[model samples]
Target: MKLYPIEAGNFKLDGGAMFGVVPKTIWNKTNPADSNNLIDIAARCLLIEDGNRLILIDTGMGDKQSEKFFGYYSLWGDHSIEKSLARHGFSKDDITDVFMTHLHFDHCGGSIQWNKDKTGYEPAFKNAKFWTNENHWEWATKPNAREKASFLQENLLPMQESGQLHFIQNPDSDFQQSSELGFGIYYVNGHTEKMMIPYINYNGKTIAYAADLIPTAGHIPVNYVMGYDTRPLLTMPEKNKFLTDALQKDFYIVLEHDAHNQIITVEQTERGIRLKETFTCDDIF
Candidate 1:
């Protein structure tokens, strides 16, 4: 299987929000903030070419949102979904699977786009089967006040409306049951209801798509949980266990939101699981 890093675009978010309880003094060292105190982040997506099935992990925040709405996030960078796809000699129509880790706007917003006439929204990947667990679909569709802003109805609903949406978890299994997305799915709830981290088997190495679970290499510290997480307390155990397993197995972590660092390998340092090395996706592949 071949994996490509799809650079959708970049955007800015409040430094405080990204780091959660971690003070600005601390997070700023790693992610320096601009004069406005917003930290730049990448909506980097992953493309999997496994046989004929071309699966895309997350769609970066699409360009369909109004300028006013986008201004709120301070979107930046030259990388775009279309340009990035074309860079790799592909296009939206080439994708066969849209495996969303969750339905948060930045992760799945690119799933739908505005029609030419601006009459209505349409699925960005018309031929791709948009994949998300049934439990997550319900959780996001009827979002609570805490997460309502992140779960935009326009980004979702259209997948189901397009008759291309499908659930991953078996009906008999618990909503949190671990499953596979062609690549194995490691289900965790700390970030949201049921975020599926894909463990992709590629090039004789196990590369995990660290979706929010480890937003960036800086979040390797166990206490660096995002306040956006519905259950930060539950996140501690999940992070600890995942990090331990990753180090023991020598897994390469493919970060989705990290702006600068694309992949990081962890090791059991004297201080605990610290980053052992950092490299680009091309370096590993």
Candidate 2:
């Protein structure tokens, strides 16, 4: 199996929102903010090429939103999914599966795109089966007031409309291996209901896609949870358990939202789980 780091694009989010309750004096040291107090955010997606299947994890926010809509996020950077795919000599059509960690716009927005006629939306990966759990599918589709803004209908619905959406059954178990995808789905609810973090076995190492649960190396500390999380109190314990297991099992974390640091490992320090080492996908894989 081969893994490629796909750079969808970059945007800026409020640093305060990214690191909830964590003082700017602390988080700013790792993820420095701009003059507007916005921190750099990456829509980093992962592409796995195994035998006949090319699975993509998390399609970054697509370029379908209006300029006014995108201005809210302060979108930046020229890196795109097409350019990144071409770098690996592949295209959207080659993707057989799109494993969404969650339905947040930044994470799964790129799953659909505007059709050629500009009449309606269509599945961006024409040949890929979009993978999401039943719980999350419902949670996103019938979003609560707090998370309604993040779960855009344009980013979803089209996959189901195109008859390419598939739900991972019974995703309540922790680290349950999906028979078809051949990856362990680590379910966490603090960030969102049933966010499926894919754990892949590669080269004698377990590489975990650290979706929003552990978005960046800076978020290694259990307390450094995102304010956007629906339940901040629940996030603390969930992060603690995940970090403890990650340290014990020697799992490499593949960061999805960290713009600068791509992958990281944690150590059980006296203070708590802390960042051990940071590296790129090429350095390790």
Candidate 3:
């Protein structure tokens, strides 16, 4: 199987919000903020070319949102899924599977787009089957007040409406050795309900698509949970356990939201699991 790190786009977000209660005095050391207190963020999506199935994990924030809506996030960059795919000699139609870790706007927004007539939205990738778990679908569709903003109806609904939406079967354990998608999936609820982290074996190395579960290497510290997480208390334990397992299993964690530090491996230290090494997709795949 071949792997590609698709640069869907880049934007800036409040460092405080990204790091949660962790004071900027601390997080700023690693994820330094700009004068406006905004830090660089990347919508680093992943593309998997396994046989004929070209699977894309997380679609990033699409360009469909209004300028006023996007201004809230400080959108910046020339990157887009279309441009990124072309960089690797592919296009939207080439994708066969879109495996979203969750339905948060930034992760799955690119899955749908404004139709040619502009009367309504439609599935962005015409040939791809959008994938998410049934539990997550329900959670996102019927979002709570705290998360309502992240789950936009225009970004969703269209995929299901297009008849191309599919769900991976839920497993008894939070961690699944292998799903029908042919990879290990680690399901966790702290970030959102039933977010799936794919443990893909590419060229004999395990690549864990650590979405919001461990957004950045800076979040390696168990308590460095994002402010956006529904259950920060639950996130602490879930993150700690995931980090411990990552060090033991030697998983190359792909940070979906980390703008600069894309992939990293963990090492057990006296302070608990910490980043052992950082790598770009080119260095690993």
| Model 1 lDDT, residue 67, Cα | 88
Best of the two (1, 3) by TM-score: 3
Query: lDDT of model 2 at residue 209?
Result: 90
Q: Each prediction's TM-score against the native?
A: 0.96, 0.98, 0.98
Q: After superposition, how far is residue 113 of candidate 1 from its true place, in Å?
A: 0.5
Query: Per-residue lDDT for 166-282 in model 3, tens only?
Result: 989878998886555788898999999999999898877899989999887788899898999999999898888788888888989999888889999999888888989999999
Return the clash pairs for model 3, or none: none
Clashes of 3: 0
lDDT of each: 0.88, 0.91, 0.91
lDDT of the structure predicted as candidate 1: 0.88
Span of 10 residues, lowest total lDDT, candidate 1 = 171-180
Clash pairs for candidate 1: none
Off by over 4 Å in 1: 171-180
Cα RMSDs of all predictions?
A: 1.9, 0.9, 0.9
What candidate 2 gets wrong by more than 4 Å, as runs, is: none
> Candidate 1, after superposition: displacement of residue 239 in Å?
1.0
Indicate the TM-score of model 3.
Answer: 0.98
